[model samples]
Target: MDVFRLHFDIDGGSFASAGNASVEVKKTLRQLGVSNAVIRRCSIAMYEGEINMVIHADGGTADVEVYPDRIVMVLEDHGPGIPDVELAMKEGYSTATEQIHNMGFGAGMGLPNMKRSSDDLKIETKVGVGTKITMVVRL
Candidate 1:
């Protein structure tokens, strides 16, 4: 299989459109004949990252690279960076506001879900700056 690449601009503060990018990525993977397990992993991880982008950052961009053996995803945002990576990675840890909680998120599961779905994950952030997360799933 050849490498396929895609990009998405996540809308900030928009719960209505949080999973759009992940949906599109799922479609792309289906079209590319990716395996069900691979697609599911990618979709789950990407959706969590997308939700995080909307909740924390005003908006951000996602870059997806699909290769024969693995899929790579990079989600970057300009929101306030995570103060503590360890705390943020906790399953029940979240800094989301009440407004976001009302929208069915902020359960503090996004990061943990992402970690669970991906074979590898990396997060880079600077307080008051932004965050960038990279995830990979083996095919």
Candidate 2:
């Protein structure tokens, strides 16, 4: 199949619409006859990224590319960049405020889950600048 690309702008502070992009992507994948396993991994990974963008950044952008052999996702945010990527990647470690925690989110599982779901993951960030995460899942 030819490559397909999707772009989404995530709205920060909008819990009600946090996962809308992922849901739409899931629907698109379903319409394209993507496998269940692929859809599940992509949706969960995208959802986690979406949540991160909303909680940390004021807003952000997500791009998904569906290729014949793999799916590529790029999430970019202008949030306070991760101070310590190694620490952030550790399970149960988070900088999320209590307000976010009360929302039943920000349990520090986002990066870990993204890593687990994607075949390849890359994270780039700078303090006070922003963060960019790229993930790839093989089909």
Q: How close is candidate 1 to the true structure, as a TM-score?
A: 0.96
Cα lDDT tens digits, model 1, 1-139, are: 5679999989896889889999999999999998999899899999999998888888899999998888999999999999999999999998999988997889999999999999999999999999999999998
Task: Work out the TM-score per prediction.
Answer: 0.96, 0.97
Candidate 2 Cα deviation (angstroms), residue 12: 1.2
The residue-by-residue lDDT of candidate 2 on 1-139, one tens digit each, is 6899999999987989999999998999899888999999999999999999998888799999999899999999999999999999998888889989999987889999999999999999998999999999998
Worst 10-residue lDDT window for candidate 1 reads 1-10
Give candidate 1's whole-model lDDT: 0.93
> Each prediction's Cα RMSD?
0.9, 0.8
